[model samples]
Target: MTLLALELLIMAAPDCKGNSVRGACGYGEFGRDINDGEVSGVSSRLWKNGAGCGACYQVRCKIPPHCNEEGVYVVATDYGEGDGTDFIFSPKAYGRMARPGPEFQLYSFGVVDVEYQRVPCRYGGYNLVYKIHEKSYNPHYLAVLILYVGGVNDILAVEFWQEDCKGVETHEKSVWSGS
Candidate 1:
């Protein structure tokens, strides 16, 4: 038998905006839903070359009644309020991560404590996947978002592939509460 990965504990907040504008990360465009593998932002200050831009993470609710076995992978898309909160998930992400309840209860979860971990990304069941965020198509050239996965070309390659709309796999569970 194989042992599963161990997750780290972190704090998160709910951000209504998911894909508002072109992220400060210098990659990806707006109109993308903040469902799985999508983070509203993490504060531009935290925005590094490729770390905060498209870093993949699995965040789970730490509190009961909202606790879940499997969590969702949220990708860092843009930047948000610079505070103790590490990542601010979009409403879609929040709805999935928050306690299992009505839409209001899910949305009501302004903030919460969650267990998170950096995980290897799986796109379309492929270890390596590419995203066409812009019309400027380029196969040789990749975006900085790939750096967030530790310079791995196997997870997310932010590039324009001429009408290729893509995303990651998710359990739909969504994260953090007050500290």
Candidate 2:
């Protein structure tokens, strides 16, 4: 919820494409079309070691004439680093920041000063979904990607509970043995 000033750049990445699974966060198909192809790659400060994935932000460029007041809403789906830019928006999302015309003029800037803040992702009619990665093997390796999370809290960790695993109940909280 903290609004911060940052610099953003435009990039032509496949993250906005509907079938590309190539990203640092490994979001797979979810990264493709989340937020209606309005996705961005954040710098290391926001990346938080893949925790930034699926996070949403409302970004507005500072250009009074070329940029709109609402700017664009985008989901962080990948990791990108630039000279001083904190965000690298896909072409689709970057173009949305333009007002009516002058899209080319805005793009000519390449990098622009922008104000951004963490925003809740609202996917209408979509509930939270977890997609098992293709590399996951039952009872051996598990890699699950959570999608459609619409809160401000960053996902820190995931716990898998098994009935066979013994756990200790402390203060009504279950603490698994080896966790």
Candidate 3:
């Protein structure tokens, strides 16, 4: 049987295991400190395919009077159970999805049913962002972390070249974040 509305009970992001980082696609450290508009996995099959790495989904709810009328747009940043109804949300997201009550009392609902759909999502920017650390000041070499902002985790390399240095151009080696 297919589930139309999310079938299982959901957990607040901070309470979840590791914030669902190494998500379904199994990459990056998507810490719980993420925004409220992030969703989790469904069945094993869905996680392996549809909602894997960079898929987007719109999850709307009406159970909680305090929830938003406009849906929350979330990226599949993590994975949940495979054989059960799953939709793990961040603490703020769940609070918005449930009754306007205390955090400890929200779980009283157990499971909730809401409308959801897969919408076209575009995170316009380099899926990978290079963060030049403050301590990365070296004359002979350079270092950085290829943070995955969006898209697939198929990064092979990061190339860099200086435009001009004393009327001379220089290009340094790229740094890979696969440690």
TM-score of each: 0.55, 0.83, 0.52
Candidate 1, residue 5: Cα displacement in angstroms equals 16
- Full ranking by lDDT: 2, 3, 1
Cα lDDT of candidate 1 equals 0.47
Candidate 1 lDDT, tens digit per residue, 17-111?
Answer: 46554555554443245334355566444345334555666777655566555656677776666335666766666556654665356445566
lDDT of each: 0.47, 0.75, 0.48
Number of the top-ranking candidate, with TM-score as the measure? 2
Ranking by TM-score: 2, 1, 3
- For candidate 3, the 10 contiguous residues with the lowest summed lDDT are 170-179
Model 2: CA > 4 A from native: 14-19, 125-127, 164-179
Worst 10 residues of 1 by lDDT: 170-179
lDDT of 1 at 32: 45
